[model samples]
Every structure is written in C-alpha cells, then in structure tokens.
Target: MTEEPLPTNASSGVVRVGDTVRRPAGPWTDSVDALLAHLHAVGFHAAPRPLGRDEQGRQVLQFLSGEAGSPDPRWSTTDLGAVGRLLREFHDAAADFTPPPDAVWQTAIPADREDLVVHHDPAPWNLVRRPAGWALIDWDAAGPGSRLWDLAYAAQTAVPLRADRPLAPTLPRLRAVVDGYGLDDAGRAALVPMLHRRVTAMVELLRSGAANGRRPWARIWTEDGPYWQRTADHLAAHTDDWAAALG
Candidate 1:
C-alpha cells in the first residue's frame, strides 16, 4: 500500500504510513526520540509516540488524527483550564528526564539541561483536536527549557497575547490558564518578564530564519513575529494591569 502524503504546516517532509507519521530525520532526531520516549514512560501520552525508523530512514511517529484547534473557537473557561492542566502535566512528566551532556536540539537555544523540557510550540496549530481532548503533535522543537519559559510561550498562544484585542478581555483567559496550571504567586509574578523574553527570542528566531531563507519561518515572520512584538509592548505598558487581572 502507498503511504499517504500528509499536509503539515512544518517546513519539512511528512507522510502517513499506516498508523504512523513519517518525517525526514535530522541530527536532532535522536534527542527528539529520546524526549518522546521519556514523555511516554512518564505517562504523558498527549504527544506522539516514537516508533523508530522506516525503510527509507524516515522517523515514524504515531499519527495523531484530527484537525488543529479552530483559530478563534469560543473557548469556555473549562476548555482554557483543561489546556493549562495538560501543559502542567506535560512539564511534570518532563521533570525527571535527565538531559544528555552532549544533547543537541533542533533549535538554536543552547541546551540548558537543568531546566524542564518544553514542547516549545504547543499552540493551537500543533494541537490535534480529538473527541476526547486536544493532544500536542509536533515534537520537532521539544527540548530543555523551564516551566516559566514554556508557560510564558503558552500564554502567547493560549491566553493569546496580541494587540488586536484589548488587554482586559484577554487577562481573564490568561488567569484561567495560569490558575489551571496552579502557578503560584511567584510564578505569576515572573510571567510577564518571561513573555517579553520569549517573544523577543521568537522574533529574532523567525527573523533570522527568514533571512536565511527558511520557509514557513520566512512565510510566518512578517506577521506572527510582529504581533508577538506588539504583545510584548502592550504587556510592558500594562504589566500591573495584567497582575491585577490575575488577582
């Protein structure tokens, strides 16, 4: 039987083979494979399972079927809470994973083995909306990062920090995710700063990728990066307001 070519927003080759997804392997593939195995061993199956390589050397992962979450779904508070909880669980499962001294990652972020591993891009696009719940799909960027680093990135995606909407309306959703994740006062206090750093790094990453002629990155850089920059700016102006929303 022929393998089905899969449509992905990634800037890489992907295909569906039986119950798995086949993608081109990179130098960082082993690290990702180890990361997925760790997630599974720790009972976090919301991510794809690594099933080894195919005949042509493509890395095979369990195919998580379903559409990506709607761009602007009417997310109930419950749904927001669920996402936060899932993310927290993911971070917890990654807690005991011992990072390799020589571990290489797909991204340029130098390995900080001390920090918790992160999904890096656990946005709606990477989530597979199942009947049961949403599951994260891509593991290409999974690597060492802290809870604040990960959660802060998540806030950009889930709380949806953007200049398009007023900060007040989005703060409640931000609070929902933070509360759901059980982030305490200290963690909450650290969030806006992390958001600033995360967005800044992401903008540089996307801009550099585009400059280097990377696709999707090149395609997304103009719009996605700028919006996050605007978010960072808005947050800078109303950091206290955001804190008020949390309280």
Candidate 2:
C-alpha cells in the first residue's frame, strides 16, 4: 500500500515520498514555490522549503516535522495568545514579498472590492505546531483579500461548540487577532459584515462549483457553505446576543 503522508486539511492532495511531500499541482504552485524559496532565503526558516516537483509532476515540498491539523477547541482556547502572535508574524513576513507570477490563488467575489493578501482558508489543518513555533501551512488560496477574511473564518472555526461563550466573547479574541496583526478599528469593523457575506458566499460557491463539474472542490464547497451558513444564521438570528458577544 502507498504510505500516505499523514493527511492534512490542505485543499489539495498531500502525500509523502520518503522525506518529501508531494502536493497537488495547480496554477499557483510555481508562484507559491517561488514565495517559499524567497522566504527561506530571507531568514524565514519556519515554513517548508519549496523543492520543486515530484516524479508524478506534483508540486513537491519538504514536510514540516511536527503536528499539524485542525484546531481543537480544548487546545484552541489556550492557544489564542500564541496563535495571535504567530499570525501577526506571518502577516509581517508575508507582507514583505510579492506573490510569484504563476502562483495559483483563489479570489472570492465578496460584495465590495477591497483586496489584501488573504490566506482564504485558514483552517486548523493548515497550521503546523513545531518546537520552534507555529507554522502556517497550505498556501493554495494565498492572494489579495481582506485581513478579516482570515479573522472571521478563524474565529468561527476556533470556537468551542459547548463553551456557551456567546459572540461577544469572540470580540476580544477577534480584536486580539486583529491587534496582533497591527490592523486598525476600521479594518476590524469592516470584518464583521464580511463574515456573514463570506458564509453566504461559501454556500453559493459550493453549490455552483458542484453544478459546474468541479467535483472534488464541489464536495467540500457544498459542505462548507451550509456549515458556514448555519454559523451566519446563528449570528443573524442572535444579532443582539452575538453583538453582545462581539462586544
């Protein structure tokens, strides 16, 4: 049997070949490779070094030697400070470089047209925990978008189902996340509504992607849309309650 590299929540396929990892090839693979290479060259040694392609033409990357998966609520609560700081570090490091010419990136058609470099899918599975620090993995959807895009997504995914902390409790966490990244109030406020928009868009994207024959993407898109919508609806239904939580 082919020894699969430990599975990750990465959007593309990820497999291990000896010590190297082979990821799915896409439009932005080259661009991400170049970005990774540049990052390594400039003293950012935390990220995996891009190693070109595997025998099957898949994009090859060095595996990060540590634990990586979705954030669990038990651990996630304790991890806020560390994760917030780590996220800030990434935004600072990544802000210095331009995306490579051939990097395959995803763009969400959000209502308005404000763009920043967003790691659209910041799922827990895309984060790696190493002795040195937390390493952000999976650069597939890295492109121009909003900081809140990541914040809203992360906040939604990071909450504990039974914690009963209300949306306001998330306000400090959200602010902590934004503050650590050095963004302003305007940017933070701008993020709230987008959360709803993103949730709504996710549902639509999944439905559309599946209808159009993008099967693999369709499945997850379908799953994510409704999942996010439920969260959006919760926020909408309990606006005063959620707003208090956000406060």
Candidate 3:
C-alpha cells in the first residue's frame, strides 16, 4: 500500500505502507532505531524491526498485525498473564542493549536509576495482543528506567489500579500478572508505591500537555484527569492491601 494514514491513533499521526508503518521522524528517532536494531540483534522478537527510511524521510517499521488495547479493555486472565510474561522477556532481552553514541529519548523525566533501556511507557494502550504473545509498540517513550518501575507502570495501567473499579475484581488479576512476571517479594512490595508515583507523573504530563495544546493528552486532561487523580490517591491509600496481596 502507498503510505496512507492508518486508523487514527490517540497520540500521533502515523501511516501504513504495505506491510510497514511510516512515522514522522523526530530528533530521538535515531536513538530509537538503534535501540530496536539492538533488540533484534539480541534476539528479542516482539519489538518492531526498523526498515530503511521511506521516500518521505519517515521512519518505517515492520508492521506487526494484532490487537491493540483501549481505555476500557476486557482482557482475559490468560491475556493478562501473557502480557506479564512477555514484559518480563522484553526486560530481560533489553537488559544489555547499547544505544547509539550520544543518544537521547522522549523521556518525561530521567529515570531514577537506569537499570536498562526500558519501554518506559508499556501501558496496555501501547501493547499489541498477538497470537504469538503480547508485543509492546510505541518505543517513542522508551528509555532508561528501572525494570520494576516499568512493569509496575504496565501492571497498574493494565490492571488499572483505580477506585471506581472494584478492588476484588482487579486484585486477583493483578496478582496473576505479578506471578506470571515472576516478580520477587521485593518487587511486589514496591509495585504499588511505584504505581502511585507513575500515575502522579502521568497526571502532570496530561495537565502540562493540555496547557501546551497537545492531542489526546489535552482531551484526557479535560475528561479523565480527575478520575485518575482519584485513582492515584486510591493507590497511595491501599498500598498496604496491594503489597499484602502481591508480596
């Protein structure tokens, strides 16, 4: 297919050409492309492979066909577990990837500590549910971050640690995911507290994006920020309950 716009994405204007995706080039694209190539060289199969640049000078990536998640997803327990396991694989595989010299990323904030190159934003929305397994997309936000923190962000967004959604229903799946990820007691204890911090940063990002007139983030800020603020509060309040369950 000639480069035609794909179905609307929440974040950016991306296009599809034949079996590849063409995205706008950014300052950090070189770093991202190098990282993906490294992941491939290191034998991580779930991430996209970078093809040569298209005629439009856009970055092209191999199109991985599968399902992406939405705000309100009805994922099966098996799907949740699979996502968890897949995330663990990605983290392990990416543990040693070295980015290009003088690399930079679209980081919201510098990681507290660089454990490895993390898909810093692995929320359900950026994941593709493939028959082979879950594949994480959108490396735009990927960068150096703590492994546990990355997984915690993913779990919180996927399990969606929140107040309106009943704790009993979400907790079991949360535990299942943590178990599937093979997280140790220490990781489990830290997950909830980290989630609280992640969501707080996310809320700030939303508000800031709104202030600056960015897409989706602006809309999300107006429409959903309050609910998520409440969710952050809930996570902070129930850290003990979560730790007891997962720890």
Candidate 4:
C-alpha cells in the first residue's frame, strides 16, 4: 500500500506499489505499453510486463523481484555476457513489432535509425538482477531505435567507457558483450562510431537541458555534466582503438 521510490537517474516519480511499479505517464505511454506487450507475446520476458495505468494516471508495470543498480564490482564476465544475450533477445523479438497508428515516443535524443522500438536506455542501472535471471526496467524510454544504437549505449554504460577508467581492461568486457550478442562484421565496424555518437548525444542533451533549466536533466547536468563531456571526449579520441579492440 505504501509507495516506495525506486532508485534511478534516468527518470523520476517511479515507485513500487505491491507487485507493480507506478511511474509518471506521458503521451508515449500507449506506445511503450504496446511495445512491452509485443515483447512478451513473442516470448521475450526480460522486461517488465505493462499493467496499464493506476488511479493516479501513472503507468503501472510488474514489480520484478530483483535488485537494481548493483555495483559493477559484483558483475562478472558471465553477467556481462548474459546482459548482451538478453539485449539481443529483446532486439530480435522487437524487430517485428509495428507501432500504433498514432504512436508517440519520448525521443530525448534522436536515434541513428528507426529500425524498430528498443529499450533506448539499457544501462546497468536499469538492469535488475533476479535469482531466476535478469530483467530490464524503465520502459518509459522505449521507442524508435536501432540495435546498434541501443547496444552502443549498453556497451558504453555496461562496459563503462568512463574517462576515469583504463580503456584496455574495459575492451575485453566490450568484446564479451559483442560476442554474446553475436554481432556481425558490419555491426562490429559500426559499433565504435555509434558509441561515440551516443555518448556525444548524451552530453549534448545534458548541456541543452542544463541551459534550458529542464527538470531532472538540468539537475543531472549540474551534478555530472562534466563527467559526460569528458566521457564523450574520451570515446571520440579512442574510436579507432575501440573498433580495433572489437575486431
């Protein structure tokens, strides 16, 4: 009966209520609900099932029993591989989904291509580790996107392409994810560039949000804008190195 707030930097007003999660709804809710429905219909169960809206008009979803935003130190190579495979499963399952006629999306950052709807933000923080398996939460960002576009962001956070960390060690983790996903040559070649673009887009989003005094984003920018900018610069400078590592 009591609403317990969920921890995440990507969105606000998300809380747990019994066996479901309730979050602020928007014009994009219908489209996201449809996307999740399709995924489950196709047998992709790594995501929370949409349960329509609550009395308060907030979107409700299955309250997955697991921990969110677990520390990276606890993540093993095997866990990273599972994350890759899970992402691949979600992408493949989503490929055949057709958006509703009047579909609206929360396209905070424009996608590289609108191949299909995807969990635009598939970072570790959104990933939940359950005893049975892992599940990705926060489907509010689900909408038009490409596999590489999604995967690039996943790798950026999961492999954690931070300016503070050494690039060499992270490369193997990146490779593990790619291998788990079974990426093709073209996908491999396109990954680094896409990663650079994704990170750059995030930096721009934070910068613009901060400039315009947007809620949450502005706050996030104030707290971590410099880190994102530095990460974007690091990714841009080492694009070739990242590509080579993937090869």
Candidate 5:
C-alpha cells in the first residue's frame, strides 16, 4: 500500500514510501513523536503511528488511507455537516489525553500559558477525509492548548462564501462546526473575546514577518492581514451576533 504519486507542496514536507509517509524531523519533531506514541498507547488510532525514523533521518509513520481534498471549487463547497462531524471526532479522540511532560506548545503566538494536550494547527490540509470521517495529521504543532483554540483556528481558515451569497454565510458554517463539536452554552459564549485576540495575533505575525525581510512569508501575512483584521472587526462590531450564533 505505497502512497499514490501525489505531488508535494510547500505547506507539507511529506515524502512517500511503500504504504507510509516519511517526514523529516524538525525542532518539534521528537516531541510530536512522543505525543503520537502516547496517543497510540492510550488507544487513539486516528493519528499516524510512529514507525521510527528512516535511513535519511526522516520521521516515518503509517500512511493514512483516504481522499485528500484539493484546493479546488468542489473542496471549497464541502458540506458544513462533514466538517462538524470531523471536528467532533477529533475532539472526542483527543479528550482525556494528558500532555506529555516534554510536549512543546506550538500553536498560536508564543505565549506563556497553561498546558493541555491540544492539536494546535487543525487546518484542512492537516486533515484526511476517510469514509468514517476525518483524521488529522502534522502533529508538529499539537501540544497544550484549549479546545476553543482549535475551534477558533478552524473558523478562521474556513472558506468564505461568494459575494452574491448572503453576507457572513461563514457564520452559519461556524455554528455548524460548534454544533458538531457539541460544546455547551458556556463554552460557546466564551468564544467572542477569543476571536478578536486570535485574529489580532495572526495579523501581527504576518505583518512582522513582512517587515523582517522574509519577502514571500511577509507578502502572505501582508495579504492576509486585512482578512484577519476584517474578521476581528466583524467580531467586534457584532458581539451580539456572535453570541446569538454561539447560543
């Protein structure tokens, strides 16, 4: 069961092997491996099993079998229900797993915070869609963080609706995601403040990167800064709207 001849991209450092994918280790690689091992020990099987490093010193793992969504129109129109279900499964699987002692926090801006085992960057490409539902990948950023962190992060990455569609259609998408996660009223209500903070930090990161002479990275942040700002503005302007949706 070798991997299919899929083209590699900049965002993922995946290399193919017979029925497995080998990823070169980085600063956080050892921590990710330990975390994945712990997860398997505790019976969470959705994540890849750490098979060990390859001859090239790349970290190897069992390849997940599923269809990957291309960044095409069809993928953009993915049903909200599927997204919700996938998130719920992830949260459920991730629940009750204590963070490893050396688990390094990687998601969001570098901040001093409490430790909780969290999947920091649970974006689309980091997810694999199987018939049963979705499974996550790229555990590099998984560490101690709040469940809201994952939720808010997902909301920010979701595809926006076309101009002709009702404005803020992504709001409904957000709701569907929450409903899928089955968060209680209190948890949902708390999301308003966090939204602004998250978006603000993202904008800052991108802007700083641009100013630091990382031209390509800087351009990405500069381009995306406005979107993050708009989302923050929307959340600020419509606190009540956000509350209603969360409720």
Candidate 6:
C-alpha cells in the first residue's frame, strides 16, 4: 500500500494507507484507542474507529473520507452550530467512558476539571466534513478534560475569537455555537471566562515551549506566538462583551 503523507501543522509522519491512517504511536495510544472504542460503542460515531496498529508498529485508524478543515464557507453560522452540536454529543457520550486501568494520556495542558475524556484539540483543522456528516480527527490529543474547556477551545477556533476581527459580527456566531451545544445558563456564564483562560493557556504553552525548546510547539511559537498573544489579550479585554453575547 502506498503511504501518502498527511499534511498537518503539529505532528509529522502521518500517512494514509488504503482505508487506514497510520501514525506514530506512543504510551498514550492504548488509552486513546480505548476512548475511541467507547465513543463508537456509545453511538457517537463522528470519531474514527480505532483499528489497532499496522505492520509498521504505528497506530491505525479508520480513514474517514472527507475534506479536513472548516466546512465550506469557513465558519458559516450553520457550520458553527454543527460544530457545537457535534462536540456536545461527543462530551455526553464520553461521560460514561471508563479509562483502562493502565491508561496514559498526552495532555499537555491541564483542564479545570477532569469530568470526562475530551478531544482537547477540536479546532477547525481537525474537523472533517463528509456526505454523511462532520467528524473530528486527530485523537492523539484526546484525554481527561472538562466539557467547557474543550468547548472553549473549539469556540475560539471555530468562532475564531481574534483580536483583528470585529466582535459585533462574531457575537451571533458565538451565540449560534453555544445555543447549538444546548449550553445552560451556568455553562454560558462560565464559557466567557473559559475562553480567556483557554486562549491564554495556548499562548503560554507556545511561549514556554519555545523557551524550553519543545519540538513543534517551539517551531510554531516562532511563527504564530505574537498572534495568539494578541488574541489572548483581546479575549481578556472583551470578557464582559462575551458574557453579554452568550446571554
């Protein structure tokens, strides 16, 4: 089988072979596999099925057929809503999952709470759109996390709370996402703050990683560090505005 390399910003050595995606495996792979299996078992089929490993000792996953990125129109109101709904389904399903006794994960950033396992990196780059529906790929980052923590990151990327983009127009899209997730009043209030924390954490991660000479993080920090720092400041500045928008 021809191993075609998959383009990704963070990880390298990912390739598609026939109907499976083969990628580097680690101590965390078993735990991730268990999480995916549980998602499928609970009927949250938007994730790829874990196919064990390939002959090359790399982890194998079902190669979902679709374009990987933000949906057409790129963060249209409808797509944002779908992203929220899908994330909700995944979180709800994950709530009942039990990690293996020896489970290990690659959670770089700690969550406010470990209520359940979550797709820590549910950004637009990891989302895939197919004829059937949307699917989130790249489960390597799957691990213990809070619902809002995961959702905040998703909202940041999908709604794209950037410093440069005007906030007025973005408010409706943020509302669309929160509403689609069916977030309650409590969740809505908490989400505003979580957005600031999540983006700030990202900036800190990049900054520290670069200082510590971490692999991809160090590399990415060199390129996008300033942008994320500016976005974090913007999120902090607009806390009240975000709260109002969610309301």
Predicted model with the maximum TM-score: 6
Candidate lDDT (C-alpha), each: 0.78, 0.62, 0.82, 0.88, 0.65, 0.90
Best by lDDT: 6
TM-scores of the candidates are: 0.89, 0.79, 0.92, 0.95, 0.79, 0.97
Model 1: worst 10 consecutive residues (lDDT sum): 107-116
Backbone collision tally, model 5? 2
Flag clash pairs in model 5.
Answer: 2-19, 116-144
Segments of candidate 5 deviating more than 4 angstroms: 1-12, 70-79, 111-115, 159-165, 214-216
Candidate 2 C-alpha error for residue 96, in Å: 3.0
Kindly give the number of clashing pairs for every candidate: 0, 10, 0, 0, 2, 0
Comparing 1 with 4 on lDDT, the higher-scoring candidate is 4
Cα lDDT tens digits, model 5, 23-100, are 867767777787778778866677889998888898888888897644322343345456655666666666766665
> What's the CA error at residue 173 for candidate 2, in Å?
4.0
- What 10-residue stretch in candidate 4 is worst by lDDT? 68-77
Model 2, 1-247: lDDT tens digits are 2647556532546777777778878777777777777778777776788898866798888878787755554344446556656665655566667765545555544424434455666656677789998777777666766556676665555543213456555655544544555556566556667656666666776777778867554776655555555666765565444343334
* Candidate achieving higher TM-score, 1 or 3: 3
User: Model 2, which residues run further than 4 Å from truth?
Assistant: 8-12, 76-78, 101-116, 160-172, 221-225, 238-247
TM-score: model 2 vs. ground truth: 0.79
- What does candidate 1's lDDT look like per residue over 121-178, in tens digits? 7776676767777688878877777788777777667767777777667878888888
lDDT of 1 at 39: 89
| Residue-wise C-alpha lDDT for candidate 3, range 134-212, written one tens digit per residue | 8888887778898877887788878877788888788788887888799887777767678788788888888898999
Candidate 3: residue pairs that collide:
none
How far is 11's C-alpha from truth in model 2 (Å)? Answer: 4.3
CA shift of 127, model 2, Å: 1.1
> Model 2: how far is 164 from its true place, Å?
8.5
